[model samples]
Target chain A: MPSWPTLRLRRQSAPAAPDKPLATVETQHGQRRLAAVCPRAAAMGLRVDMALAEARAICPELTVVEADPEADRAALAALAAWCERYTPLAAPDPPDGLFLDIAGCAHLFGTEAALAEDLSLRLQRNGLAHRIAVAGTAGAAWALARSATAGAPCTVLPAGAERQALAMLPVALLRLDARMVAGLRRVGLKRIGELARQPRAELSARFGPLPVLRLDQAYGAAEAAIAWPRPPAPWAERLAFAEPIGTPEDLSRALAELARRLCARLEAGQRGGHRFAASFLRVDGQRPAIAIATALPLHDAERIAKLLGEKLDTVAPGFGIDAMVLEAEETAPLRPPQAALADLGKPQDTELAAAIDQLANRLGSARLWRAAPHASHVPERTVRRLPPLAARPAWESDPAVERPIRLLRRPEPIEATALVPDDPPILFRWRGALHRVRAATGPERIAAEWWRRTPQEQRPETDLVRDYYRVEDNNGARFWIFRAGLEGMPRWFLHGLFG
Target chain B: MPAPASLAVLRARLHALQPQAGHGVLPFGDPRVDACLPEGGLALGALHEVGAAGIEAETGAVAAGFIACLLARLPGIKPLFWIAPACDLHAPGLLAYGLDPGRLVLVQTRDDAETLAAMEAVLREGAATAVVAEAGRLGRIASRRLQLACLKRGTTGFVLRRWPHGRTAAVQEATAAVTRWQVAPAPSTAAHREPGPPRWRVELAHARGGIEGAWIMQAGGSSDAAHPLRVVAELADAAPAPAVRPGRAG
Candidate 1:
């Protein structure tokens, strides 16, 4: 368990003075109180939830800073992400603590006690005051880490010893609310051992079922689920260095090795990934990550490395990185490999898919698309964008209808005059230029889809009925113009340019 | 001065020195137009530049349509990449030129740099049969890079010059493209004062080993999708001039 607010202040303040005390204050129940205190302040008879005025009176020189729960939570979450270097199963225990499920990962650092010691030392070096307790279950570890009776800063409870170890701690360490703790104390139950001695039925009848459930959880008799910050990747490869490496060449080499290993694993499983993320853990506890996505499922190492190499410059090695982890976040089963025959005239589908991926990863997937025809009479609504490799149906269009090559995103209003109420324009002025219409085509009337209109457009005057015309100017430049509205001062607009 | 056998060897060497000599050609299928080109058609595995004449260069509608027709003539069902700064090409309009919208992969970029980069990448990949890019400017070095990429994979590239903001002096800068053209809308020969098929004044402004000429070209009728563009008449003032061979005075 980490005291987040003061830890954050300590981390922010450079070369913190040892004798000065620090406390973070917040308004609780309409009264300002100390939400968290540093070790010096705690030693000076100050506690969390104590009145701010009372704390100030006792220690007039206390460094009081306003508490920011949001910042503290964010810092805790970052720390949890950094802790992924220890185990992939790390989660932030809100407002203050972190939970690391290092069941099988302890062997990497030698033993559970050794791993706890290493974590505690690193936290201390980073200017954070924390308690590390390793146990058979998450609940037992969380409860033990917050208890003051735990002897050492790094406590490792042996298997099957949670009940004995938690007997003497206060019942509040079981994560009970203040009201429940007060109710339990009113019944002369001040310790977890006293609460656990009572019969389950009696305890449920007296203080509800929470106390019983919590006690069972602490003893490993019931499951305690932890919400992981990120779902563990299905496939991952990690590389740890004995000394920190920061040069670009070293990072690229490490990344290449990791990609090779990961791709081998994927090949063995007959799987390919669409999304891959690589995270670099720095010695200063910063995790810089870069992710790349493919247009199709891919398992080739060279292509993956090339795609990731384009983004390798973005990672900043602040104090030098010590570990790197590459994970495949999204994966799918791939088809079995087939031997190649003689070279055909047509390009392979994989070659096109690879090209699409290269461009999509650099310029974004939305920038690349294939056009698919839509069934609509409205010119703008006649086409939609689809993925580059999507199988599209044949596009069928009327051979007689002439459409402009380039369609403006929006229509520009123009001034035009005609001889009749519903005829093509004889003259028009567009973009500050006047043009005499040399020849004109019919008024292809197009009405707005009544079913697509909203209630606000239900008025009669708001109707959008357009009479489209393909007209040519004296200079031989053709334009697609439309006359909008059925009555009263019709308006002309230039919508497209003919080739 | 030389033996007959040595003359044959020298002729083979001359052919080898010609750019994209054996890569093949895509003819306009009109003798009037093809006669002006040294290879009787547009050279494959090379870069070509197309721009609209005068102020019409801003929209580049005519140049786009011309490139679409060229792409439709490319001899395979391989994919085609059309890279542009904006998504403005109307799919149905491309169908009018016999180019299928289904075979085109449209890539929209933020600026000219990205558009050129995508074009080079696609050309280098060698998978696509052709690549058409709509860009505002192409310097000498960029065009050379695109030409080299096309040469590597036997892919043809077309650069349609469009100045969406306004025309600038960059339009006149020299490039390494094999051919450069300028197209302007021309009056259609329709009866009874009605709009007819689209027509353009197509000018072969520059070619490596061909004569300069201009002609009145008209798009094919609605029924003729296979051969969509035909040369109607030649402009007397812009008629075919003498071929300007390399290292030779006019």
Candidate 2:
């Protein structure tokens, strides 16, 4: 049998305790003394759920405000980001929950219960109601916390040990339909322990795959991966808080621990990541987390912390936070050391890169990029824009033939009404401006490569030649102009201007 | 008590923090392009550029594409930054040649002028080997100012000029840039042929250490050295008959 908290707040964000609700306290002045008021509270003479209007008749005034889900989400995300200090695999469970995969990390954290106690104490300090449970499988832990609350020992099942681990958690932990649980109840199966003794075939025959699946999850037959509110982030560190943190400094220090771990991983992999996420969990059943993503994948602790700190103002911990998570997404291989001893060290590159990363994190990744190279001869086609720090370039990978220092995206047609047909243009009109050719150079005839030209590039053989000329304008400023025709015969076009 | 020159050199070397690339770091390819870089390549630091006449706002010519091509020639697994103005930078065409957007940083600024100043500051940081900026006009003093900054940080900066219709741009005689180039759209043949990259007619207008105009080289593509660049007019071109002695035999 399940018991909803008989006590409810006159106004509560979520349905107070679906499995075992929390006692309602309208105005909490101290930790131990929570003035109770609710349906069950009324029955107990606490009268929590009474309308402020009616409660005023019963009592006097009640504070009511629409729940800010955004705040809750931010806080949770901030907690998750903070959790990154422990492990990168942190995610918010939603409404008010967190899913941290501590696989292979139990020893590092000492023990799951210790980790849990750590969370509990932190939440208590933050004035939050934290119900933390660790189980062999996410389903088992979820079941244990939601179905079996308060002092119900969280059974740890060893590898291939879900059956033993989840045997104690109630069947309700499986989250089966109420009708199914009722049906099972009618059949005299109540606790998870009762169902565990039943044959799998009978359970399958009676409840279908769901029962079988949940049983398997509880017993390690199959794994139940929790559907995280956000995608599972890649993280390698975790810090279980001894005391929940409310200030930015505490949050920063916690994040630093995770950052250090991440830096180690990055150094080992010889890679860096631009986009990073940090999540936090508050103790007040409110989950507010912050995610900081950068434009460039970076590995400096101070810079990253500074960036996250800039966004700290955006996070409102409401009450306080218990745990924090930080993880990195969007990674690239580390740059090979190309340091050279020049006269003095320049901070521009690193500073700019860092600034860009912060801006990219604040803006969407799509908005920040570096110009990329394209193959098209068209000036515009030759240049591409891509996300910053997103590539391992092949630019310096060959003995390249000397290329023109000047390359334009599109050819500008010039009006050459006055050039002899058989020579480089001595004069031409372009962009409604006239340019007189001062010192003339021979036409460097460029023909399109036939083997590679597609139908898009096919033209009559006669127009195949491009007679280029380096003509110094009367102003002594040079212009690279070309004529689309045979030697001497020219159709002028202005290409590039020399600076 | 004068320190020996060797000792002074050793001390200088010892003070260095960021280690230099070992011989094994032989650039994967394109050593020539690397040769021009401070660390035999774009150093793992900042680079900057200054542009004038709203050049940064336009196709990002002075500020964006130039850097893309320069970086494209290197093959290390690092990132590049196109710090425009803390805003306003697009890189679609850049990826066609394989510069991943994920490895780029575009800092679009609110305006063109501000972007240049910020770019100078970024270059002074020394962490990046390059920084490019676009300003309304980089006069001699301004170019000199930026050049000094680049020299101090061991970074390189490219200043772009936007010359309006028929109006000549002001040229700065003093600066640290070893070369100045003007990028414009290359000419294309109207005749049908296998399509190829748009050919650019490079004009080396200025150079400090190397011969001016010596840098005029063709944009190498799928062609070979014998036919390094396209020479058009096959049908209409009258080839000089191969020089041959009149056949005495008869």
Best by lDDT: 1
Please give the distance, in angstroms, between residue A206's alpha carbon in candidate 1 and its true position after superposition.
4.7
Which residue pairs in model 1 clash with each other? Answer: none
Alpha-carbon RMSD, each predicted model: 5.2, 14.9
The C-alpha local distance difference test score for the whole of candidate 2 amounts to: 0.52
Could you give candidate 1's per-residue lDDT for residues B65-89 as a string of tens digits? 8888888888866689999987888
For candidate 1, the per-residue lDDT at B42 reads 88
TM-score, chain A, per candidate?
0.86, 0.49
Q: Which 10 consecutive residues of model 2 chain A have the lowest summed lDDT? A: A1-10
> In model 1, what lDDT does residue A75 have?
82
Off by over 4 Å in 2: A1-174, A177-197, A201-213, A219-222, A229-234, A238-258, A264-324, A328-408, A413-416, A419-433, A439-469, A482-492, B1-134, B137-250
Cand. 2 TM to true fold: 0.47
Q: Candidate 1, after superposition: displacement of residue B231 in Å?
A: 1.5
